[model samples]
Target: MTSRAAGASLPGLTGTPLDPDQEEARRLLQEELDSGDYRVEESWLVRLWRWFTDLLPDPASFGPLPGWSTWAILGVVGAAVVAGVLFVTRDRWRAARLSPTGPAGAVLDGMRRSAADYRSAAREAMDAGRLDDAVLEAYRAIAAGAIERTLLEDRPGRTAHEVALELGPTFVDSADALRRAGDVFDAVRYGDHRASTDQARAVLELEARLAQARPELGADRHPGLVVPS
Candidate 1:
């Protein structure tokens, strides 16, 4: 009789099963091969390019248009896309220009309302129990009142913190309060925190005190002048 090789099954035992260890190993190898974890993802720029190309009219549908014509069409579409991007981000660009040196979200966009108007609005909001709105409007009143009184220059990109620091020397007694008020304003305006009644009252009281206090503007009165902490 011919000798069979080790671990080799004879023709009569073709149905022989693998050992438990071998079966488990086979399963683990198969799983590793089938997993999607190793697949490389396409970069965003590549995806964007694919999307743009997909949006273009099929050249075949254009009835054998000249190569130059195809390029010209692509140029027009590209220009339109660029224009749309700029239009959508126009506000951010304006904000950047207005506040190149200020903190993020600190840009005081040009407000059409005067300081008195903001103060009145803040009071109304407070009475109506809109603490958040009261805080916002009261901070605006502080900024606007300073600008109106020439304590702060009415520049396009002036921020709340900048206003506080600039007016620190002028309002020596309330310097820390001004800084804290600025913090409260930023928290309500940009942070996830909501304004509480106490915070609203604090801002309102600060605004009132600032209104009553006279600013000491001297020969050094100018923009970008910050008091040292």
Candidate 2:
């Protein structure tokens, strides 16, 4: 009896008949392997490439989104971004609005009083034992000094606290004093707390300091001033 050779192809295995499509696929696969395009599964680069390809969107499998829906999604995202920006910048915008150069200052175009007058009034009030009036006048003197130095612009209806807030940056060295004077003025003018001669004197001292002080060069300048935009 004759036996088949060890390398001989069998009909059930290597010699099985292939359809046209299968034959073409096998031929393409062989060509790819010969051209070094076929990578082994054990290769790290091959695994990484497969992972990256899997993560990509399948355009053919998933239908494209409608134009309106896409636009709506984009619009919502854009609006959210704008809202976030506005929220972050709300304080800055408010500061700019309340600035001497802003609309807040427009109404008080010519309503500014001289610092000397305010100081004189403060001294008179102090001599008269009217601590409340002295505090108010002293605080006004500080504001007047700020205006004279162009560190602030006069605006009507602005509270003492508001003025201090605006001038705090301009008087970095005297920021605490300005704020304290504002608080004292507010307490005497608005609150039920009565002003004392000491408090009035403190405000006067702060006013003197502010009057002698120069404008901070690095301070945020008014928009009307010729500053680097």
Candidate 3:
């Protein structure tokens, strides 16, 4: 018939006895509290704020406190630095993911072949009446030849329009041909248009012309500059 205070024992069934381990734990907790070694319960927000402040450098350790404004400025600067670092790291990771050997393998996703190989393929496709394939191969041959002749660098994911633009500035004499070829290729590739034998033949003829075309160096060009072999 003894009454116990709410904090004297753990609340459970009215007549339930405390286990020996529980009693020991309660005794230890009480001793710690009496000795002022126990921490008071903190709200979640206060705990999170404490953790965040712990991550920052101590202004008092650096020097005498200028003011609260100085601490606020330091906190802002620290946050900006962290944000900038995170942004740069994210960009580098994205670049790596888009690399030739990365997961996407964007640079190596397309068919890699020599100009002669592409020409052979084009001929076979044309003979088989695969006009679309023929046109695609013929365009590939043109791009391959330009790379081989050092007229253009082999860049992945370059659209036909981009190729034509690149060629126009370098092979001024074949600008019209390059543009036409690009237009035809883009129409077949992206515009849902069917390729014709004539279009394929035109692309092949343009490729041949571009293979022989050279860059028109202006008078202001470096006289000592040696062409890439």
Best by lDDT: 1
lDDT of 3 by residue, 125-177 (tens): 88899888887778878777766655666678766667778778777878888
Residue pairs with backbone overlap in model 3:
none
Score every model by TM-score: 0.50, 0.47, 0.46
* 1-229: candidate 1 lDDT, tens digit per residue: 2333444553433534333377765775576666876678899757867888898778787587776986798799788778867998998974443332423465355556888999999999999999988988998898888777667776876677888889899889999988877777776676655778988999999999988886665536655443323
State how far residue 65 of model 3 sits from its true place (Å): 99
Model 2: CA > 4 A from native: 1-112, 218-229
Candidate 1: stretches off by over 4 Å:
1-103, 219-229
Among all candidates shown, the one with the greatest TM-score: 1
Whichever of 1 and 2 has more lDDT, that candidate is 1
Q: How many steric clashes does model 1 contain?
A: 0
Better of 1 and 3 by lDDT: 1
Deviation in Å, model 1, residue 165 alpha carbon: 0.8
What is the C-alpha local distance difference test score of candidate 2?
Answer: 0.67
Ranking by TM-score: 1, 2, 3
In the predicted model 1, the residue pairs found to clash are: none
- Tens digit of lDDT per residue, candidate 2, span 78-118? 67656866998998974443333312222112456688988
Q: RMSD to the native, candidate 2?
A: 18.6
